[model samples]
Target chain A: MRVTVNGDPRDVPADCTVATVVAEAGVAPDERGVAVAVDGDVVPRSRWAATPLNPEARVEVLRATAGG
Target chain B: MLDPRPDDLVIAGVPLTSRLLLGSGGFTRLDRFERALEASGSELVTVALRRVEQAPGGLYDAIERGGARVLPNTAGCYTAREAVQTARLAREAFGTDWLKLEVIGDRRTLLPDAVELLRAAEELVADGFVVLPYTTDDAVLARRLEDVGCAAVMPLGSPIGSGLGLRNPHAIALLRDAVSVPVILDAGIGTASDAALAMELGCDAVLCATAISRAREPERMATAVRLAVEAGRLARGAGRIPRLDHAQASTSDAGIPDLTPAP
Candidate 1:
């Protein structure tokens, strides 16, 4: 299935959770400074692991490590 | 109880995950400032404007590296006109309408002049700026500023750089109840506990510099402050139980009261 990741469309395996998408996108599990939002709603850190990603989900990840 | 979430504290509709706001000054190096910002979990950071004499230094880049929304402060202006002009300059330089308006009346104490502050806030609000004035903890002045369309009113806990914490919480509470805008406790925070106390008094946020930058370990202290603000905000939401005049304890019932027992 195709999902938009951080504003760029990318193909991922169907029925993947947010944690699986994040891991597949080459982001380390312990990475800091990345905030994930799905359909304009921020996914809290606690719920990220269990949030299932739909096939056409739009995900935006903001990293505050670079702007003030 | 769960901590107060990001939706609890907001400034002008901007959601802030951390109740602690950082000031981008007093750091020896940009890297240190970056570390401190990350550790502080501050979503809003303040930067002072300077005249572009020779060239724009790396401070802007450093601030960008820290990744927080920048709030440019008008630190040294004395009059309403001067502050308005400085706000324009800051807008042109920083490309943001959000301003931390500081209109000083006296050179000795450097306190904000209530009259000039309201005057500046009125003009700035008219000019389509989000004015956040740093002023004394006066309920009247706070109400006036709010009436003038200020986005927020930042009352100093004490004198700037004093690190004395909230000197007049009663006045702060009055302002909190009077104004509709966010009441941010700015300046005079000495330690993590100080920031926590400010939050416990129902402040929207606390802005500080020396307490974080001047500490022995800025990063660690930044984390401490972040946790402190969260703890205090939770406490405020949880509603502390009142104390009683005398001590009391739960007791077991005696056998003499078993009139109809074992029937």
Candidate 2:
């Protein structure tokens, strides 16, 4: 399956989970501030590994950054 | 989740210690962010949620050390859907439902898109988020935001980072009376006096970023803004004198002889 991870296009094997996309985007397993959202729906941290991804899915791995 | 002291800033039942909600933007380094937070004595700080491209160990560490509650903002989102998505991500990343919702209308103006903002606010509020929308200085729209069960309404004094200060003090005052929720001046603050003016105009609090972060002396400027906020709050409580075309003399006619020696 082809998915966009944090705006980066990536080709991962079929049946990829949200955790696979998140970890591939440089987020550590122990990273505290990271969050994943697939197709605009927030994937809870506990469900990342269990959740499956669809073809051409857009996964956003977000975290807190400095802002006004 | 610190309980607010008596007479403190309470929004959506969350009591905040300080009225000056500082923004963690425009700093080149992490130390300055920490120092500015310290100098301002601000108990609340705003941050944005973006793609996690790299490990943000330093930023989180500074925030932890600063001991200020984080208020995640949708600074760059332009649409209701986008802002809502960003808010969801922010809640998960920051672990706070308190959101500074910004739906930018025009890039050059950096003004809030009223239509989009209200739509997003309604959705977010329904989702159990404590919505604090960054809005325009109009009482009419502020009322709508309040009607949607927003925790607070943040009306911008001017464009984001414009440093123009409160462009319309009368409208801001009107907004303060219009909304029961807290009124926080969100942007366009140039210096300490600007922040003071915000409070004097009846704002419940002020959220400033470039004014303090981009100053020549960020830390000192932060302290100045803090003091100005306090002074303005006190002055606002003190009734102001009515304006008149002519000046009034402080001394009585009987004291005129004191200066008559020159004749």
User: Alpha carbon lDDT of residue A24, candidate 1?
Assistant: 65
- Candidate 1: residue pairs that collide: A67-B67
lDDT for every model? Answer: 0.77, 0.88
Write down the RMSD of candidate 1 (Cα, Å): 17.7
DockQ each candidate and list the results. Answer: 0.01, 0.68
Give the per-residue lDDT digits (tens) of candidate 1, residues B1-263.
Answer: 34556456766666667778898767766777889989998877877654222122455556667777778777778999878866775665456788989999988777899989999999999999999999999989999999889998999898887788889989888888998888889988989898888888888888878888888899998999989988988888898778799966567555556567675
The 10-residue segment of model 2 chain B with minimum total lDDT is B254-263
The candidate that wins on DockQ is 2
lDDT of 2 by residue, B187-231 (tens): 999999999999999899999899999999999999999999998
Docking quality category of candidate 2 according to DockQ thresholds: medium
Candidate 2 has what TM-score? 0.93
